[model samples]
Target chain A: MTRSGLRGLRAAALTGTLVLASGAFAAENPIKLGVLEDQSGDFAAATIGKVHAIQLAAEEINKAGGIMGRPLELVTYDTQSDNTRYQEFMRRVLQRDKVDVVFAGFSSASREAYRPIVDQFNGFAFYNNQYEGGVCDGHMVVTGAVPEQQFSTLIPYMMQTYGKKVYTLAADYNFGQISAEWVRKIVKENGGEMAGEEFIPLGVSQFSQSIQNIQKAKPDFVVTLLVGTAQASYYEQAASANVNLPMASSVNVGQGYEHKRFKPPSLKDMYVTTNYIEEIDTPKSKEFLAKFKAKFPNEPYVNQEAENSYLALYLYKQMVERAKSTNRDEIRKVIAMGDVCMEAPEGKVCIDPKSQHMSHTIYLAKVGADHSISFPKVWEDIKPYWLGEAGCDLTKKDPMAQYTPSNPPPKP
Target chain B: MDIATLAFSALYQFGDAFAFLVLSACGLAVIFGMMGVINLAHGEFIMCGAYVTAATVHAGLPLPLGILCGTLASAFVGVLVELLVIRHLYERPLDTIVATWGLSLIATQGTLILVGSTMAGVGTPFGSFQVGAYSYSIYRIVLFVAALAVLAALYALFNWTRFGVLARATIQVPHMAAALGVDTRLIYSLTFACGAGLAGLAGGLYAPTMTLVPTMGATFIMEAFVTVVIGGADVFLGTAPAGGILAIVKSGMTSWQGQLFGQIGLLIAVIIVVRVLPKGISGFVLRERT
Candidate 1:
């Protein structure tokens, strides 16, 4: 070989080694946490706080020397509250951004839209919104309170405080339908008769007839599973129409913070069961709120979903630290060990290793006439029992399918 | 419940449904029905009205005054939209649909950017009155009366006024009306503005009963479009009758079955009406009279 050619070859070899060394160095860099949230559109009002909460969690983690000396970096994308956007953005964050972990989805539709994409990429995700439960995916961790945690506490209290006859107004969708089934099951189990039930389509704002029907039924209390901006108006319409029956809901005052949005007496005499609301007056929650407000002062209310999102990141950090690695399989094994828990703003929240859902401390909140929230009851350490009973054990099986009450597990 | 109470309940339901249908459709009746312009952004115009009303009310204005401001604000926006966008698309019906749809998207997103996602809602006023087992919103009754008053006002303005004749002439035969010294352009702009104002009025009226959001306008668009299509081209002859029949079908189905069946029945009714009378209720009534 010529002398010049040999020098060129030597330089190329040095360049290759430098590139490999830099690549190896990059692995020890900040861990990328993908946050795909509905920053705009209909669900934005409800889910925007979640993005803030995640940011706050990341800031705190980075301040405390992020998971094993690697700083936490957020790769955020606004899904615009559209399912198609959720899919598109989920793919973008998972593939192009090469994020280590993704925390995405507000609605069940949004979650289901991108869930398959997450599975296809063999990526890990966290869905931290309250839903109808029964999602048995090994690739995902759901920190939200499920039907077993919410309805189990809410229904009996409602039935006992009011009467046995209950009227249910649910949104017309998978979440609503499945949640309604849980309500029916719980109501029946508590020996309460359902006076009436109606599934309202998402955009049906007119509730005069529904109110009139409820009055005619004369139920002791009303159970509302209404979701979204339009369905939320039922409170105003019902209040205006003087449908004086007390209302019990698992979704309303907690997720949307409707008590803060609506005028007084609209949400009056309403009972809501949730894991967290800004009204939660615990020392830890107060400290969390103080930090949150100090960070994002313009935020109206710290909703239940935000707390879930905030804690999920800390939970992820804990899992990553315990596993001592960022590998998806190692983290999954750590999660399956059933010991991952966090001192969340909502209290002691633990990951149920078998179901991959959170065990929450559910609070029964009542809305006063002035729209003030009061927690009259608390159910501590409510396990997501429904999925466990439905035979969801992520360690033994990876169904990658959601189970509903009607669709039970196949025979062993 | 006794038969008397049941009868009152049925009547109340029908009235409420009728009021909702009529109010939702009234503005679209003028814009789409009379003007032959397919305004897909009709809902956003309503949103403007609601937003203005809610914002103004929260700013400590009286409710009625706030509603007036809302109506005027929407009307002014309508005029701007007409001058800038709608004027050019007057001869192009299909293009207007696309343009207005684009405008709706812009308006919804723009509102979101400006005011954020939502504002605190205005409380429904007028309290309630009990009939038997059911207590009804007096505000609902007020809405029913307001719907009638709006329809009656529209009927009078278009039928008994000089501007109404000129508007009809301009829309029906624009060149002829222009040649005969009527300002066809002015008539068109004014009529469009009126339609938008009426839509704003609907928004203002219903703002108190709804949770206000940028997308809240969509909740009204379906009913509005349905009512306008069924009402046909003649606002005076078609809108009220169409609203009445639809109200009966919707309320009756809702009362008998539930909301889902009620919606299904409404769609079915729309299908039957369109299939049987392609020109709509007004067209049929006009044909029979002629």
Candidate 2:
């Protein structure tokens, strides 16, 4: 070889050695957590809170020394709130970004749509939202509460306390149909009869006629499964029309639900089955809230979306560490097995192994006079609570018990 | 709640939705029917109108004055469109549709790039009130009334004014109108501008009901097309209001039935009814074209 060629070869060899040395350093390589979601659509505000939560946890974890000493990287995409895009985007994150796990898929439709793709790619997904039931056998890990969290706990409590009859209104989508069906089943099981059921287009206004028809039904209470800005609009219309039954909603009637346009004083008597209430005053929650407020003073304190997003990131990092591998299937098993826990204020947040759904303490909160939700106690006996949590509990107690204590209490 | 309560509730629901149908359909019918341009970008025009109102609000103008200014800005934009790209594609309606559709995409994306992806709520023009078991959104009621007033003015403008006659003559026979010393191109340009302005005003009115989003135009555009097609492109100004009302009834009924499927099914039913009344329900009701 010529003298110049030898020098070039030596330089290339030196670069290769540096690259090898960097890879050999355990903490040098970064593991990516893809948070693919529609942070600006139907579930934008809600998922935004979750995303923020994921980020907060990731930051803290990295500061405390990241999973396997490798820092976490969070990349996000806006799914535009469509199921197809949601599925497609996550697939891209898995195939292209080669993320160890995805930390998103907000709605039931999105979860369902993305499930097959996750299985196809054999990638890990940490779902950070609540969904309808009876679906299991997915590689993904759901980290939010389930139908049991909302329907089994809150609906029954409302039925026994308020009345054994209720009227329900749901949005006109797959999530609505399944949610209403679950409500009907739970109500029937609890000796409650559904007085009436109504479905509205996702965000179309003018709900007066439906309100009037509902008034005629005169159920003990109203249950709304409305998603998006319609929640505020419905309450506004209902309050103005003097439709005065106390309400229990499947959706959170908080800041993200178009509070800028239509904050509701009528919602004073309203309640919802939420994973987190802004009023919860845990050290972690307070810190999260303070950090969130400091970041966006004008924006209302973080909603469930940001919280879930934040939690998702932590779960991804922990699962990856527990598995001791960035391999997708290993991380999937770690999350599904509920190997690690996060200090989620929503109660002991864990994924059910079989169903891949989050099993957490579900709450039935009443909207106080101050326009805030107050949870009386940690709610229990939420159905399909943990996807695999129940399956692993081979020896079981009375499943019919109204409220039971959390197996392993989340952070005090 | 009595049956009267329910009926009244249904009436109001129909009224408000009908306002959207009419207001949006006005633009859809004029652009599609006269120029044979789909003008899918029409909703973006409405969005621009809304943004104009927002800009006016940001400029410290009173709400009503802001809305009025926004409407004028929409008119100006409408005229600009006619003078520029849209007017050139009049003879090629399909090309117009495709080109305008591209414009719509560009405008919507441009909005996203400018304002933001966050949905911002606008101030409602009217306060709210309740009656019995039904509450009426004063803003929506105002929309219904405004749409009615605009429809009446449009009717008078077309049936009773020289401009309307000239426009009608040009639409019926563009070449013949030119021989009669009429400026067909100017008439077309004016109508196109009016349609575009109407769309913008709609955006302004709808702002309170929905937050501003770049892609919000897609939903309204589809709904507008359905309303226009079902109402009959000819004499759409009259049926435009009806289309809005019909959507209200259909959506309300969906609550009693299933979910969105019921809404889709009802839309199909409307199509069947339209087939039966080819000239439109208005022509069928009148027994003649007039």
Candidate 3:
């Protein structure tokens, strides 16, 4: 059969089912949610957890009779960590499958690739991953911690507690570059000095010379924005070289869950700022974790990305119920109205009316000697400040643009 | 930094980077230079070694024994690959490339299914010592010595042993050596095993400083192929000199600028060498007297 003919047949069958369901079930059809996740590729390690967490949320929601008297049907497609696949599947989800909402994208690159399709089709997407953020799109709701939310609290605490001189190592990419700029801004804001900084390519794992360079600079602490499994070599190499300058990262720990992946003492004394870790002892987190564990008993520990997915689904549910409809336009209007909040496993999280991003709590934690993470202090309700700095009022919907630091700090 | 400290640091950096390039490329150079077959699964062979070493160590073996086990395991797999797939494609370069590339994909995905995407690696042995104002890893120094030792061992074996002589003669003149009662095919398999064993050793040694992932081989494969091509067909002399020059240039550039520029320097160095000396550094070094 011809490809378009097959699609036509599927489309006709889908409409027929919708008509029958609407006629028999209170004139309401099932609300379809699209899930595009990286299940078996480079981003799989971090994103697979999010996929499971979303599934758990959908299962729980359905058990409670769903929203608006319609069962939630999740249509999932594994992107296989390919950006081209993301674009293809996004088009199908937004146009052919016609899902009301999309909970997708793991990396910043993938998110950018799919964003235009969502805009062109007037589809709503919820990006549920922490990143170096400055996205202000009316059609998308970003539920991840931006650099300002993560670093504004982390840098000061690190500099004051550790020392005033910092050495920064970042992956030579947009996320790392922007996050490194934020490090400089936050360091300067807190009266700290950048002793040295260097950007390594993403796949260069040899760190011997880099370590020697760090040792010579003699920084109070080393701040890293390195990404990927290759960059994780820094932890072991640094430990072996005894360049023990009390390291921390704006990236790492929770994202890859490196603490669990690497042996102890390598990550000991390292600090990372995150929204959630499985070790949070709060009653709300404990209950949610227990429920998650009960559902998937053998699954590895949950990280912030998984918790973000779990939280974003509930927020989507809340908005859908609040609008009393699953229509994309109506749901988008309800989101623009703002004031929707959820008591997430981390803390109380709400949508910032101006930026269309999440305002949530951030925690500063240390990787313990036993490879478990523990929070030393919690910064409550940090808003996404970069969008506000750029005057990105998404409710006004002036521009669907990303804001980045224009004047990056000069190298030390 | 003081001049003395600076010079010592530069030398140490050179040694570390030189050892890295030499270790990663030596195995592939041997296989390609000696056997005349392009082993596209060279990286997968290294991955196999690393995974086996990590898995063995995790299963409660001593670190040294685990490393040895990794080498032996990779050698066994190499022999199996030879008997099954590689033998049929001998002297057929393009076919060998395709077959070996298919083998690499199968190895990677199969391991991903059976083992996992990521596995914990053993801790780096030894610690660090202060060098002037800077500190250097002792394991990196160990790596430097190990690379030179492997090169010298290969040289001595090829020059002094009866098996090495027979293997060299077989590669140089298969028909003549076979007519003279040498088991030419067996020599080929043995040489291939030796190359794979070297790769296994490199991977086992490097496992401690890496995150053991199924796709970790891709990180090492590019530099390996580059060094081998720039080294030409003379396995010992070519591989060593080319790898050293590339490593020194890369390490110096990394210290002067950053890792990005350092990698760019290495690639530019390779292009310049390939363009200027088509026979590679060894061919140039081993030129006949006029």
Candidate 4:
């Protein structure tokens, strides 16, 4: 062999030893969990608690000896409530940092924006916000409550307590549109009539016409699926206009904590179906809230989304431990095996393998005249039945599609 | 419902729509219509007013006093803004728009950084009265009256007061007004201040009805701009009638269909008016009178 060849062989041998040493070192290395969420922007106020919750969950897991005796390291990015930022950060986290798993996206638009990128990288992610149902992706887990989970509990209670006639004012978007469809279906199934339905575009603050129309229709109650800060003005406007019809919503006081934010009687008599709220009066919930407050002393409220975010980390940790590996495919396989339950602050929440959605307890919370929240009723362990009914068996096949009422999977 | 009740509902809706348009637009009317500066920070000024009013009310002040404080505060800030930023960009209309837009972003973000995103909102004070099956807010009626009061106040300020005459002369013919021994610079500052104060007043009036947020100003901006645009440059001749017409179109379409259609109708009406008249409703009216 030439002298240059001997030098090359030595260099290769040295590099191989270094690689072997690093490969062993990798097991001791911290697991990188990417958190992509809106920390500052349009949805910042509503989502700040969520980010804090993730942080708290990570800290707790690290304190308790994280997944597989490896410390959990968070790689968080603020998407700033912008869709483009979601895409950019998703790619950065998955392709660049190569996070083991990502918990990202607040809005459906945001989720959809970064979802394709996740698929491209074959990445696993969790969307931890309540939304319109029917996202069946093999690479993602939806930890938030879907329409079937929320409306199935809410609409029936609304119809039973209030009357048969319903008026729905939904935000004009995918979440709102699809949720409105669910409202219609649930209302009809419960033998109730939809008096009027209006899809108010986002950023529409004025609702005098809407209030007037609601009065004209004279529904027993109004089902408001309004989203965003601007749309929250509907409650204030409706109160001022003295449209005294009891309002029921899946998205209002729970996520935004509108009752706590707005003054007395604005959200009075509002029936909100939620998985969690700051006012959840349970030992576990209180303990979790106290811990959260101790950590994030300035956080406004522990919203439903925050609870979902908090529990999602624990869920991920459980999957990692059960799978005995942080490999995405192994974790996904563990998820597909069946129920992976966790004792969440809200209640016992379990992951449904068939649809990659959660089955959890949902509460019917009512806002009193003084803006206090009270749980009047609750449905336990409500599975995400709509997707399964729509033939979205992720175990059978991953269509990687979102199904709406107008668009469903072909009947099996 | 009875015919009388139906008519009352329609009338109430018209008043509500008119109040919203006029109040939101009045400040922009003075800044954009009179001074020819498209003050994009108009919304920020409104936000300032709302924040101050809400904060003051929460701090144990009466609602009216809080509103007065909010207006004065905005006017003071307007003067400062005029002296610092707007004065430099007066000759550059497009630059003024950009500068004010920048100012708006800074104000919004600054408010966000300072006070966080949301604060507790003041409750709408007045009770509602039932007519047939429908109930309407008395505060909304108060809003309508406040809108008219604001317009009348503006009219009196411009048409009746000595400062109004000077402002009018200064805005219309600056050199002529300057040569005639008018302090044109002071007039410009005062006019801008008044415009901002009116915007603040709109914010104060509506603060009770809105969810007080850093970006709450955006909700008012679209209507304000459209109203000012359709009203034309002549604030006195333009704004009230423009508000009235737009209110009619908005309320008509709203009652005919829903708020979505109402908004669509308002935009469509703006398009048609801008297309035909080119200048605006006031321009058409001015031409007819001429």
The deviation in Å at residue B158 for candidate 1 is 0.8
lDDT of 2 by residue, B76-118 (tens): 8888878888878877877887788888877866766556554
- Each candidate's interface RMSD (Å, one decimal) is 0.9, 4.0, 1.3, 1.3
| Residue pairs in clash, model 3 | none
lDDT of 4 at A283: 97
Q: Which of the predicted structures, 1 or 4, would earn the higher lDDT when compared with the native? A: 1
Root-mean-square deviation (CA) per prediction:
4.5, 6.1, 5.9, 5.5
Model 2, C-alpha of A216: deviation from truth (Å): 1.7
lDDT of candidate 3 over A267-300, digit per residue (tens): 8888888888788889989998998999988566
Off by over 4 Å in 3: A1-30, A95-97, A407-412
Q: After superposing candidate 4, which stretches have Cα over 4 Å from the reference?
A: A1-30, A69-71
Give the per-residue lDDT digits (tens) of candidate 1, residues A1-412.
9999999999999999999999878765889999999987778889989999999999989888888989999999989888999899889998999999999998898999999999999999999999999999999999999998889888898888889998999999889999999999999989989998989987799999989888878899999999888889999989988887899998998888888889998999999999999889999989989999999998888999999999999899889988999898899899878889878888898899888999999999999999987889998999998888878888899889988988976657
Model 3: fnat (fraction of native contacts): 0.77
Per-prediction TM-score to the true structure, in the order listed: 0.95, 0.82, 0.92, 0.93
As a whole number from 0 to 100, the lDDT of residue B151 in candidate 1 is 88
Candidate 4: residue B67 lDDT (0-100):
94
- After best superposition, candidate 4 residue A369: deviation in angstroms? 1.8
| Clash count for each candidate, listed in order shown | 0, 29, 0, 0
On residues A136-202, what C-alpha lDDT tens digit does candidate 2 reach at each position?
Answer: 4445555556676777777878887799888988876667777788788789888889899987777
- lDDT of all predictions: 0.91, 0.67, 0.85, 0.90
Query: What local lDDT score does residue B155 receive in model 3, on the 0 to 100 scale?
Result: 87
TM-score winner, 2 or 3: 3
Worst 10 residues of 3 chain B by lDDT: B281-290
